[model samples]
Target: MLQFLHICNLALLDEVSLDFEAGFTAVTGETGAGKSVLLGALSMLAGNRVDKTIIRGGAEECIVEASLHVAGNKQLAELLDELELPPCEDGVLILRRSLHRKRGGKVQINGALATVTALQQLGEEWIDFHGPGEPQKLFHEKNQLALLDIFAKNSTALEAYQADFDQWRGLWREMENLRTAERLSPEEAEFLQSQINAINEVDPSDESIEQLERDFKRLDNARELGQLSEQAGEGAREAAQAASRVLRAARELAEIDPEADALAGRLDALIIEAEDLSSEYEALASGGDFDPSEAESIAQRMQTWLQIRRKYGPTTEAVRAKRDDLVRKIGSQTNVEGQLIKLEHRAGELEKSLRKQADELRRRRLKGAKDLAAQARELLTKLGFKKADFSIEVETENKLSRHGHSGCRFVFSPNAGQPLMPLNKIASSGETARVMLALKAVLAKADATALLVFDEVDANVGGEIGAAVGRELAALAGDHQVFCVTHLPQVAALARQHFLVEKGQDDSTTTVTICRIDEDKQRRESELARMLGDRDSKSARDHARQLMASV
Candidate 1:
């Protein structure tokens, strides 16, 4: 249940805080006193779209927030947990929405940033609004079926049906996609196959390309490299021979002087270094004799790698990746006929399974619709529509559809002689309200909507009928919080809590204010009398007093 609401800079409400409770709370005031604005605020809380223009003059934004106690709402708690939203700590769930001019708007649940879609899901679980525009919701086929299912307590069965339908839909999409993929055009097939054949011819390894290029370079310049190697080898041999002669002379002198011995040792080191250089030259010269035929083959292979790189990718790894993709794609298209046959058989099996499950679902709905019609008719009779005929038109299709096998239509007739037609075509907004009221009374225990707001449900209703509606709302409030905006004294007098919306203007600014009517008899009676249109009249006060006592 919604425990509190706060509004700021919205419409003509600069700032307002309302304390709400579980039971019938009547909101009444003169025409154009901003009661509807309060309902608008509630609608926003229910995740409806916001209009920034509703912001009050000179205000940058408008804010509306509500605190709900959700400890008892297992469905809501589970939904919150699933969405990874903030849980209702200590049973308190805070929801807030704000509209801004430049930045649009935002919704927050328990102070965590949230999406309006999440709030809409919450609305589905917690709030049900019935008013001027809401009765039309009952005319929708899905809504009609939902009401019947709620009455039947068939949510689990419906959940199973929905899950299977989702699977069937996904399978249907996959099969279609596979069929489309299996039959490629001739040109597409040729292009991909040609790429595959080319890739197969030159299976380049990522590790060998650079080494092959270096080998090709050396082989291609073989004549120059071999000559250079021979010249270096001869130069090292000559240097070693010359250094040995110098070392021999130095050693002979060293016998005569120790200084000569040090010079001989340096010459001996140069001769040893030259000999090592000659061995490296010989190794280099040996590589220069690589086979020309082998070199030509390597050159041809390098050309193929170059061509593959240009056509497929810059790197051998990239070519390999594309090669695998082409193989799979071409193979799938080439073998399409067999794949299609198998897929078609599987799809047929899934459809048959879906139809059988949907048949059971439809059977349950048809049985539940009977009880729903009977109970609605009974409740409407008590609400002053004794001759109204209510029925649920459940039409079961030959096969499963996107939603289900059967479609539900709510048909209604207010008078005995009238033909039963769609509720939207037959019922006025007032009659729609009564019909909704009857439905709510019947499904109260099965429904999980925590809040119900009625705007002008008393429209075109008076005296006895108005009192009946009030009693029904009060009774309905036994399970959920109910708020009714009205001009009738009977309904106003029945409120366990009463609030009056009043329009006032100071200078050029017009504002709407709401205040709770005190429990004192004089104050409550005075407000009821004002609603009666004669605050000071003795008869009006007496009538108000009588209405209060009846409650």
Candidate 2:
């Protein structure tokens, strides 16, 4: 519900501030008294685009600001959270927009700088306008289907159907991707297989590669290494024999003199270490013969390692990873046909399930459309459409959509014996407004938008029928906060709050002012009397008083 509105330097409204209540509120003025300026200010709050001309004659900017009470609205809270804006405090949300002559405009929500797009999103969840151009919304097939779904209470069933449809779509996309993959040419298949074969033949590993490299190096210089080992062994043996001779001499000295005991112990340790070194060198000298065949095999393996590196990567690890990936790809390619068949069968099954769900939804929509159209037509009579024909037409197609297999259209004939046509193509602005009103009245409990503003809804009607329209709007307020810009005293009299828009001039500058008159009974009655065509007539005042009494 809207709590307050403040407009500054907008068109004829130089500056106007008014508080609003959560019920049917009427704004009344003569045809050219600038009542539409109030609607323009609201439209701006709803994120509608405005030109610089909307700025007052001498002002540089136009500002539209509103405070709305939006507590316990989960969808709204979620949207605000998504937009990263301040949440409503004490159930109040402030939305402000300012238009400048040269700098365009700016929007703010709850003190945070926001975008017009964000305002648009929040506006959908907050207010719904049902005026001249707004009524065309009902002509859209998507909105028409939404209304029918709401009236039918098909949320649970619709959710289930949509979930199934989404699953089917997922499967379909996967199958299509597989089909595309399976279309690979024979050359492509051969290339993948060859890469796998090349990597597998080497079967590379870090330890195996290191060992091969060592073996290759030793075999390549075998003759030199063998001769060097033999010479080192002879030298080590001579050194060991010399150490043994020294050890025997030292032992004899120790036996002769106790002072030589430490020298004798050191000679004993050196003799053992020299003997071990001599044995190790002798083993290397006679280790094994280097065969030419073994040399060739090691060389070939090394060559293969080099080739694999150049082709795939420069490291054994990279080659191994590439080999593994190629194996997986070739495996998938070999089984592509079978996978495609399996997916096709699964998708077919899902399609059958979706068809059944679509049929169920179509049936429910057909029933709901019938009932909804009948209820709206019944209310249309009360809104001055005595011989009007209104119907909700549902056309079922074989193809499927997120909204099921049925398309909905609102068709109307304002006079008897006329062919029913789609609302957008046939109904005039006045007729469309009234039809929207009737529909709103019929679906009051189901419509969740907090604010509903009706403009030009009382067009081309007067007297008891105008009062009937007023009564319908009043009834709608039970479920929504309603604002109607009306020229009829009957409608204004029925409102819980009444605001009067008046145009006045001072020094060639014209301005429009809006103020609440409902607080003062005489002022309200006088406005109503003025609407009745004669504010000072005794009969008109009496009539206005009677109308107020009825409320």
Candidate 3:
């Protein structure tokens, strides 16, 4: 239940703080008294979308805040916990929304920054707003099925069935993909096979290709290389001969003079070095002969390698990778039949399971529908629709839906003589409002939420029926908080908490104000009379007093 609301700079409201309590509350005022503005501000607190234009002319921003006592709502507490929001102290949940003219808006739950989606989710758990021109969930077919499931308490069963159904659908999709792959034409298969064979015949290797390349270069320049080596040998031989002749003369001189032993030693060293050089030149000239046949063989092998490289890849390693990929693809194609068979079998089993579960769910739903129709009929009778006929039709579908194989349609006849038809087709706004109220009255016993707001629920209702509507709302307040915006005085008289919304204007500005009424029964009677009739009417005052007393 809402404990308090503080609003500032919102539309015609400059600043106001309202304290709320449990039970039925009513807001009553003349037309154009900013009643809708108050509701709009409250809606913002309940996480409705905000527009910056609602800010007062001189204000830079607008703020709407609410404090709720959520002691009895464990579901809402759990949701807050899931969002990692701060826990409520003394079971109080504080929600605040602020909108700025320049920057965007911000939302806070329990003083923690929260996204709009998170706030809206938490708000839904705490409050439900029924406003004019707003679509009603009960009238939607999907909502009708969900309501039946809730009434049956078959959520677990329904979830189990849906899980199997999803698995079945996934398997079916996989089977379709496999079938499509299998439908490839013979030309495509032949093309793939040719590519695989071509890659295999190349038999390329990185090390082998590198060695071939080196041999090809050497062989291609064989004539030049041989000439350079021959020139080098001739140079070494010429130098060796020149040194030998000089060493011989030096040795002879040394022999003739015994005092020249040091010079002779140097000559002996030079002789030895010249002999070693001569031997090296002889080895170089005598080394293996350069054969033109071997060179031709290397060139031929290189040409073969180049041909393969140009046709397949720029490098031998790239060709090898492509070959591996083709091999894997071929293997997959060869085993595709077996995989298809396995998937088909799995899909069949899942379909069986899905059908079994869906059938069981349909049975439970049928039973639940019977109970829901009976309850709705009873509730409608209490709301002054004495001869209204209501039924929940559960039609089985060939395929599985999220809510199993059953589709729910809530059929009704507003008058005694009329045949039953869909609620949307048969009921007027007034009849629909009453019907929705009656459903809410019944569902309230099962719904655990703390607050429910009805915006102008008295749209097309008046007279004694208005009092009955008030009575029903008052009864709902026994266990839940009810906020009703009404024009009918009979409904207003039943409110334990009464508020008056009055709009005032200055020279260039308009302001809306909400005032809590704390007056005597006589004063309330005078106000009710004003609501019922023009200010100067004795009969209207007497009638208003009677309406108040009756409530």
Best by lDDT: 2
Higher-lDDT candidate of 2 and 3: 2
Q: What is the lDDT of candidate 1?
A: 0.84
* lDDT per residue as tens, model 1, 54-96: 9988899999999988787888889998999988999998999
Model 3, residue 268: distance off in Å is 40
The C-alpha RMSD of each candidate to the native structure, in angstroms, is 4.8, 3.3, 7.5
- Residue-wise C-alpha lDDT for candidate 2, range 1-551, written one tens digit per residue: 99999999989887878888889999998879998888888888887767788888989999999999999888999999999999999988899999999896999999999999999889888888877765345668788788889898888888988898888788788878877764547798798788777667666888888898888788777777778887887787788789888888898999999899899898878877877887887777665356778778888878887898998888888998888887787777787778888878987998888888888888988899999999999999989999999999889887877878888889999999999998777657778789989998888877788999998899999999999999999999999999999988999999999999999988988889899999998999899999998999999999999999998
Q: What lDDT would each prediction earn against the true structure?
A: 0.84, 0.87, 0.79
Between candidates 1 and 3, the TM-score winner: 1
Q: Write the per-residue lDDT of candidate 3 for residues 1-551, one digit (tens) a residue.
A: 88999999888888999999899999888888988877787678767776788888889999999999988678888898899999998999999999999898999999999988888888778887676654466768987787788888888988888788788888878877777764435677677777667555534776767787877776666556566666776676676677778777777887898777688787667756766776665565544334668767777777766776786679887777777776676676777789989988998887778788888888998998898789889877767687889888999898776667778899888779898888677446667777777777877766666887787667666786788889988998997899888888988999988888888888987888887873567667766888888646898888877877776
Q: State every prediction's TM-score relative to the real structure.
A: 0.80, 0.89, 0.67
Measured by TM-score, how close is model 2 to the native structure?
0.89
lDDT of 3: 0.79
Candidate 2: global Cα-lDDT?
0.87
lDDT for 452 in candidate 2 is: 91
Q: Candidate 2: worst 10 consecutive residues by lDDT?
A: 130-139
What TM-score does model 1 achieve against the real structure?
Answer: 0.80
